[model samples]
Target: MKLRAPISTAVAISFGLLVLLGIFIPDLADFRNRILNWAMLLAALALLLGLFNLAQVHWQRVRGREATVYSAALLVTMAITFAVTLLQGSDSANAEWIFNYVVVPIETSLMAVLAISLTLAAARVFQQRTELMNMVFIVTLLLLLVGAGPLFGVELPYFTRVINPYINNVLALGAMRGLLIGVALGTITTGVRILIGADRPYGA
Candidate 1:
C-alpha cells in the first residue's frame, strides 16, 4: 500500500480550506497574508538547499581530480556573486550595476543565440513541408511579428483592424480566463484528494 495517500488527503483539505476562507471570509485576510509570507520563507529555504547541493557537487568534482578547472570556475563565480551582493547590499548602486550590466547582457545574448536555433528550425519545417500548412504558419508568424513591431511607423490599417480585436479580446482574455479556471479546478481536486488521503508530495 502507498504511504502517500493519507498525507495527500490532509494537505488537500488544508489547502482547500485556506482557499475557501481566503475568498469568502474578509476577516481571514490577515491569516491568508501570513500564509503567503510563510510560503516565501519556505521558498528561500529551498533556494538554500539548492545552493548547498551545487557547492557539494563542485567540491567533489574538484577534490576527485576530475573537471577541476570547470568546478573551480563555478565555485569562483558563486563566491564572487554572493560576496558582492552581501558586501555592497542589493539596493546599492554597485550591486544594481553588476546585475544590470553583467547579468542582463549575458541573459540577452544567450536568448539571442537561442533564437537563431528557432529560426533554423522554422526554416527546416518549411523545407520539409512546403504546403498550405507551411504557408499558414509563415503568414501567422509574419502577422504576429508585424503586430508587435514599433507602432510609430507606417500603419497597415487593414491588418491592424482585422487582427487587433481577435488578439486582444479573444486570445488574451481567453488565456487569462482559462488560467484562472485551471487554478480553481486544480485547487478543488487537490483539496478533495487530500481530504481522502490520496495526493501527498511530502513524506508525511
Candidate 2:
C-alpha cells in the first residue's frame, strides 16, 4: 500500500517516455506498438466495465420508489438492443433495423434540437450584447440556416449556390481546422502533464 503510488507513477512515466521516444526513434517502434496494443486492450476492458456500471445505476433508478419511467425504459431498451446484437450479430437485419430506425432517428432528432437550441442561444446573445462580432455571428448563422434548404419550396440561386457553399466550404472549414489545432495543442499539453507526473489520471 505504501509503495503503490510511487510504483504506479514510475511505471506511468517510463511508459509515457518510451512511447514518446518511440515516435521518433525507429528502433523503439515495435515496443511502442506492443505497449499501444496493451493500452487498447485495457481501454476496451474499462469501457465494458463502464457500460456495466451504467446499467447497474439505471437498474437501481428503475427499482427505486420514485417515478423513473425513463430509467426503466432505457434499461429495457439497452438490454433488448444488446441481446439482439449479440444473438444476431451486428450485421444482421434485426440489428441493422434497430440501429437504422431507432438509433438514427434518435440521433437525428437530438441534432435538430441542438441546432434549434444553438440558434435560440445566439439570438439571445445578440439581444444582450449586440457587439460587432456577435452581430456577425448572428447574421452568418441566419444565412447558414436559411440557405441550408429550400425556402418556401423555392431555392434562391444566390444563397443556395454561392453564399451557402462559401460559408460551409471556406469559413466553416477554416474554423473547424482552427478548432482541431486547438484540440491537438490541448491534448499535447495534457499528455505532457501526465508524462511529467503533474497529472495522475491513472489513480497513481
Candidate 3:
C-alpha cells in the first residue's frame, strides 16, 4: 500500500510536468492536445454526472415531501429546459427565447442575491472592526458603484470619465492581477507538495 502511493504520485507528477513543458516546448504540442481532449471528455462526463446527482437529490426530496415544492419546481424547470434544447435545437428561436427571458432573469436574480450577501458581509466586517483594510474596501466599492455610469445615468467629466476609468482599468486590474498571481503561486506550491508526497489529499 505504501509503495502504491509513491508510484502513483510519481506517475501523476510526471504527466503534470509533461503538460507544463508542452506549453513552452513545441515538440510536445501533439501530446498536450491529446491530453486536453481527454480532459474535455472527462469534464463533459463530470457535468453529466453532476446533473444526474442533482436530479437524484431533488427526486429524493420530492419523494420524502421535504421541500417538495422547490424540488418539483427544479425538476420541472430542468425537464422543460432539456426538452426545449433537444426538440427545438439550442440555436432555434424557441431556445433563444427561453434563454433570454427565463434564464437571463433567473441569472440576474441570483447575481443580485450574491451582491446583497456581499454587501451584508462587508457591513458586518465594518461594524466589527473599522480597520484600514475594511475602509479601503468600502472606498473601492463606492468608486466602482459610481463608475457604473449606466445604473444612475449621470456622468461627471472629472469623476465618471477620469477617475472611474483609472480605478477600474488601473486599480481594479492591478488588484485582480495580483490576486491571480497569488492563486497561481499557491497552486504551484500545493502541486509541488503533492508531487513530493508531503501532502496526500487522495485516499491511501
lDDT values, one for every candidate: 0.80, 0.90, 0.86
How accurate locally is residue 71 in candidate 1, as Cα lDDT from 0 to 100?
Answer: 96
Against the true structure, what is each candidate's TM-score?
0.72, 0.80, 0.75
Q: What does candidate 1's lDDT look like per residue over 1-204, in tens digits?
A: 655456456656676578668878998888877887887898899998999899999999999989999999899878888888999899888778879998899999999999999989888887798799798787776676677645678777656766855766787689889999999999878767655556555655
Model 3 vs. true fold: TM: 0.75
Better of 1 and 3 by lDDT: 3
Model 2 agreement with the true structure over 1-204: per-residue lDDT tens digits: 265478888999999999999999999999999999999999999998998998989888878844489888888899999999999999999999999999999999999999899878877898899889988888998898788888889888888889999999999999999999999999999999989887887774
Which ranking of candidates, highest lDDT first? Answer: 2, 3, 1
- Each candidate: RMSD to true structure? 3.9, 3.2, 3.5
Candidate 1 off by > 4 Å: 1-16, 130-135, 146-157, 160-196
RMSD versus native structure for model 1: 3.9
**Candidate 3, after superposition: displacement of residue 94 in Å?**
3.3
